[model samples]
Target: MTDETSARIAPPLTDLPIAVSERGFYSGFSKHVTIPSKIIISLLIVWAIAFPVNAGEVLGIANTTIIRLFSGWYVWLVGGFLVLSIILAALPASGKLRLGRAGDVPEFSRFSWFAMMFGAGLGIGMLTYSTGEPLSHLQNNPVIIAGEATALTENAVRSAYVYSFLHWGFSAWAIYALVGLAIGYVAYRRGLPLTIRSGLAPLLGHRLSGMSGHAVDIVAVVATILGISVTLGLGVEQFVQGLNRIGMGDWLLAKDNSASIPAIVLALMIIVGASTLSALSGVGKGIKWLSNLNLVLSFILFAAFLIAGSALFSLEIFARGLLDYVTALPALSFITNAPDGTTIGDGIAQWQLDWTVFYWAWWIAFAPFVGMFIARVSKGRTVREYILGVVIAPALMCFVWLSLVGGTAVELVLSGAGEGNIVGTVLSDQLYATIAALMDSGLAYAFSVLVVLLLLTYVITSADSAILVVNTINAGGNDSDHGRRHIMFWGVAIALVVGSLLLVGGLDAIRTAMIIGALPFSFVSALLAVAVVKAIWRDTIRLRHGIECTVPPEAKADPAS
Candidate 1:
């Protein structure tokens, strides 16, 4: 069980040969990663800002093409990740494998860990989509389009949540858990650096230490940036809408009632600036505090909905939705539709492209940042615990939020309390309209203010965590405080990306770019699934040989022994 014996029995886990700058502002940064990622992203920002129409057009064409070609790939690949994650966790041997050294304990409390995981993973989406998505699907989904259910009815509610849970449920988290588990196993158990390339080391071996590895890291960096940009863009839109609802007037929005360019710029200035400061404070202090505050505010908002909104109806929806989601998960996960030149088929196909395919791409693009953040905070947990926490726990929370928050919207619309406003409002305005329908003017205004604060915290937490993750990749997984300038650099880069994309084509442009960027990383994620399985299988063989698999070679021997 000694480290030396284990080292001799197991295949070598080599260190990545990434070059780090030793001096100047880029000190401790990997030139291979930082320079290329910055250049690519900077060029994108400039292009989007300089030629807005052309950039939007190109992005639109590229997004359409990629989605058309790869929609099935995105669905099946993500479903495979869920199956793989469950298999890995269900196996007795792999499930017991620890993510860190033998004596290492968890770095954060369970509450703090879950808070950060949930906050970093889906907090912004919960605020933006919990109400909007279910309401949208209630109006039109495959079930409604196929005549299986009437729009805005009870059966339609079931259909709505089935799709809602499909997007935000286990499959989405599995994508994140797979990457996090892969990187955590390699980085913690094998003593590799905590970077995307390190997760593939088990399969690619030493080849990953060169340009191939650098390329993987760069792709991950770009994906992370775009993913964060899309999230921030959506969050800013909702934030501006909240401001308008809370008496900021129509001036905060443009003629089309979307967030104006000036509003987006101002919001990003406040958000990214605060996020940069939080990134400097690191995950332990500022990020954790913000995440905790986010949860508190979230609970308050949820309580308001439960009390003043449709509590009994939402509870019923939650119960039935959970059942329907579980019953339909398999079909929802693997099934894809192609336009057959028929009405229902085309509607189904387009729905998949808009909702399901878009969500899969978003999750894939987000995996690097969220996965790395989860791995960073999940050092000492077992594979089963990690899966349960990353995949199961947060997903249950999402179901509740969708049911309660979204169910309230549905009930108001159905009961005529909303006077057609909730369903008729835009996505960003839907949450505010729901609040207005739930309470009187004074209470609704106050509630809107609380929601705005919650949105701000969620946005800040997501932005700061993503900045840290990008910096970690660029630093070759150093995870040290030697990259303050790099942190600020990424923070600014993300702001410019979000700002420019928002100005040109709003959330649509950012979504297009994210889907396109996610394509490359989807392949990388598939490799991660393979690598982790290979690693665990090989380590199982070693375990059968009486070789210790958890402890790395550098852990010191017991002095008494």
Candidate 2:
């Protein structure tokens, strides 16, 4: 059908540029998208296959060239934007603007809202990094490396948790919050397609319906896929580590190593299989239930650490780390640490390339999915509430989690309670091994079992939500019930991509892919920040002029073309 013809019959439930295809693999799949989006997806699929197939050459070149070049700038840009998000939230006028209509209240309860956001935002990353990151940092962070006398001194340990908080704190979530606020305000308040392109609509207006808009959506889609796949691959590796430590050790070790490609494949099969089922079961049922269960299990595991370990010490670490995180924010936010041979600046520069740059890229890559998902669930909240919930709540949770689990583990290792090299295991990406080392046989087995459960649930929450988000973008931003075929396609596609990258070069390959995907979206995120500011400024002016800024129902979508 022609564009105008389709518009005439198109349902108001969707703002898709074309009618929903009735004869496709999915019910709500878009029959029309800008040609540029199609070309971009095709190119990305080819790139995914080619780079992995020639990993040695392609990855080396990309890492030394594209990835390395952007790493330095990403740290500053991402940190600056995050600080900007806080300022925007602090503005008296902007804080009061609601995301939805004036009378609309939150759809989910407070607990459910936080649970879903937390589960989706951090997921298995928290499980993998909580203990591992602090231990890794304790052994060698910028502060400690700059001539600290003892590796496990209080100064070193405190610095460890501070970096942890910086990585997982307001800065990370602020990326997601900016994108979410932009998309939610433009899409809901302005009655536009609920897609990444719509986030730029305020800046571009109807021009967002052109090739420029297509490029934005395409970049978002590719970034979301790579970002989720990186997480999926990480989750799979940790899950395998936990499983092998529990019972499958000899079998996996007999193949190639504990983290053999075969082992990773087997892990993916199980995780992707369960995640696909959850995606098919739809959001309200499978995803919600699994997220809630993840939260409960996570609580139990974290509480066990807090109770069994140095509770007083952990609390002290948390309080002190929180202070350090705040005090150090200015330096931490924008310090690029340019190299100048054998100096603290040079060392910090390398560290930024390795950790801070990598994390900022990963978070930006993740922002499109997490941001969109947050926007979806955060329909009726005010800008301030949404920003605080996204930025503050999750960061606080991470501080407590890192301090308790990481603090306890660091104490054990430094005090010489454990024989295992926690730093070595973590650096080798076998963090579950460290977790096992920290507990007794019975407790270790229990911890492994709980971790596996949490892993599966967190992966499912992430994958299912990503499937929905990608399909939403694919179908031109209509988030109606997509066909099972489309959902399952993305599930399997993610599995294959993660598996392919793992086989080629493992985590390095995955990390490079994420960085590349994020490079483009970084520009998109900057535009989103600008669009949000413009939108809020306009809303502020309307309110000051005694005008109701909310769109009336009849104006949300037209019945006649």
Candidate 3:
């Protein structure tokens, strides 16, 4: 499984030595553990006990701490560090991040690869939140247009979509592209395995070699699991809530909090079972099919919403949304003010932080895993092409989706169609229901089912990707995908952990756990910035001392930064 051509040890990018043996151990584990079936069974058992017993005050403290310490400030910390990382990726030394030249196009078409990576990485969040959040924001936006103006107006509708775009668009994807460019360069070009700890490899040099590397791998494995689990937990809640709205009803909510354990276990089983199956299908066959299917279903749902809902009003809202979004982009970019009302002008500043900075932070906590997944599938593309695809491509898709779905929802409510009070009744429960309500017959019912399936598929795709990334961390990127048994082990284990935590705490509790998990990765991200910059600066000095650089950076490459 070794190739001399790919044998150059990825230049240690951290202050630690490359723990070759430790990495090899985890890599071996990844190659050996792939059992989808066992993963499900074990997930059920663990979920049975994680709840009922652990649901109490400690978790309460965790929730309060999360809101105070991480929730409010996360955007600033994550966003600030992200800008710093992008600047590092812009240097000529960043050419190292380039993978093998668009070498012999692979079997999958470029678009297919992009679809799988994109769907697996972020599609889950988009599907669950797109329609609902924008509507909610529109119902409340008074600060944007008239600067503390009246109630919801035409401009309020516009401002709503602007915030949705802010949450899902360019500012969000920037985190992924920047991280991918840094880690992918080391892995693809310099031959390092794809692992989060390696993001700091350039500065560490050979130091990542022993216990230190193991520490990095373990922390990454834990953080990634918690982070991905938070998303998966949310996915299960949304799916159940969506199903309930369609036909399933509230029994799924559990009679007693103790009964909630089985619900979580069942969800974990579905997620782990599907993902393990997809993982076994290998990255291309199973994952690609699922991802392509997800994209098609998503498009179909968008079409259904537009055609069935009020089209004209949606269009007007979309146009205005874009204008307000553009005008307010600078304000949302990074400004922050505490909600305490310390300064008169500070209230204005806090709005930007609440929306813009919060998203930026969410994406930062999100970028490591998503960036790794994107870079993993992005080989054999030019540096410029990769950055553009990863950043611009996804942002455009999100914007279009928001315009259609979010715009349609607001129009439906405003124009007095089915439910103007839809936001108050069940914003979380009915986003998908509204989609079904638009269509009039068995066809709508069928489409709703398809939406559920697609949601499940993307959920599995995301979990599978998370499983692989964690394995990579555990194995130190020994290059192999590990054994089916091993992969399944973690898959089930993660499902159990997520399900258990969900039972013990619920979505809010799991969210608190995630922000807690993010504390470490957030620091890792900061270190990644420092290491990348140090390496880039050192190489820049070396390059200057050597040949007269033929093409200036701005000329040879189109930098996203």
Candidate 4:
């Protein structure tokens, strides 16, 4: 076919209409999405607050049942997402398709883009898990339980990193990348609203304009709230602990060393208040500034570990651990341990649930917030660039973090530098404990302050970015500024969810709620995988027929229209 003929036959990129309130409290918002999401989240908050013990018990039971029933599904779905992301990026036709019109240029600099992406996607997680995960896996993993390696020994270090890298590596980022790619392609190229349902446009077509679409977005909003709540909950624990370490007094923590209700309340107020203010400032200014600051702070922290805490050992671990992780990735990605009524089988099953399954759910739950944020900032990039930027680059950065920070913790335990203090402490305390072991009292306190500052930025960045994402979805993918009131509303709502759940059962309660919330979204994510592939396949056919795959500038529909 000739170019003119192909152009004539090319599909039109029409705007998908989404209802938004022009008046009332929800003015400029999609009442269909916003009202239901708010009601659902508000109900959960009231439940946790009114009946803390019962809320925790119900959440725990629901989490257990969901994990038992869907563990393999989570495993295979996540693994398949990774494979699908790679395939889409690797194909010549699909890889070259731009997210926006041919004349469009990227809005952010490469460095700024990466900074925001990493900060929103996994910055808090890197801080929370870098040391804790490696140390925990050092004590126990499936390989350790299987008797292939002994825990707390040199022989087990590889297995520790293998699992650590597994949880934090490519597979995790693949979930985020696929979600972003799907939504970005549909919204940018096809002129659809930049919401979760738009990602399935290729499969759902006009059905996305109705209640079915609202359901998809509601699932996304709930999952995003719960997902970010888990991060905030964990960060609050560490934030409170950091305060205690810096001489804030024993009143901040309970007899068990966990943050008390008062401490949790105080931390939430500070974090959510700051985050709401940042959200009002919008992404380009507040979010970008915080992301860059956190990246620099993260570099400084990593450098300290390199200089003071077993640099050579960490470098060795980086090299070997990365190799082991890469070599075992395929198997690790697909591995599912079903209970066979044997002790070992049950042990492995529980271990998988605690570690791998939980991490998958966490990442999946997190995908909508991070993915939408990424898609917003990542216009005008190719499929190949998007995948490489989103998946490969951050995964490499995570590996470096695991090597330097986590590796140092492992070295300390092996060499007796920590004298069991690091391993003996809670996950939130491990980072502080490691720093104390590495330096004198004064320097350690100074370093702990820096760590706390970094944590604060990460928490604010995640929370604020999430608030923007939720607003974006609620407004039916409207990227324009929502009034400050809406931003504050979400910030306060998220604080309530995190605070009430933390009061109920600490981080465990928050985690259980997040996992349960992530379940429905997991199925939605699976559909997203299929939708993206179908869209790309059809686009490739257009490319082969001499038709432009991207919507032309003049043909593109305005979402507001």
RMSD of each: 3.3, 5.4, 7.2, 2.5
lDDT of 3 by residue, 259-339 (tens): 245455676788889888777666667777888888888878777766776677667766776677767766665555455
> Candidate 1, residues 1-561: lDDT per residue as tens digits?
798765546654645566788988788888888899999999999999899999989999999899999999999999899888889889999999889878888999999998999889899889889899999899899999999999987778888888998899999999999999999988888777889999998778777778999999999999999999989988999999999999887789998889987788889999999999999999899999999999989999998888887889889988988998888988888998999999999999998999999999999999999999999999989999999889999999999999899989998888888999988878988999999988899999999999999999999999999999999998888887638878888889999999899888889999999998999999999999999898888787777897666647365322110
Per-residue error at 179 for model 3, in Å?
Answer: 2.0
Put down candidate 4 lDDT per residue, 154-182, tens digits, no spaces.
99999999899899889999999999988
Error of 1 at 420 (Å): 1.0
Candidates in order, TM-scores: namely 0.96, 0.91, 0.81, 0.96
TM-score of model 1 (CA atoms)? 0.96
Which scores higher on lDDT, 2 or 4?
A: 4
User: What pairs collide in candidate 4?
Assistant: none
| Count of clashing residue pairs in every prediction | 0, 0, 43, 0
For residue 437, model 1's alpha carbon misses the true position, in angstroms, by 0.9
Candidate 4 ranges beyond 4 A from true positions: 1-13, 552-561
**C-alpha RMSD between model 3 and the true structure:** 7.2
Which prediction has more favorable TM-score, 1 or 2?
1
Question: What local distance difference test score does each model get?
Answer: 0.89, 0.78, 0.62, 0.90
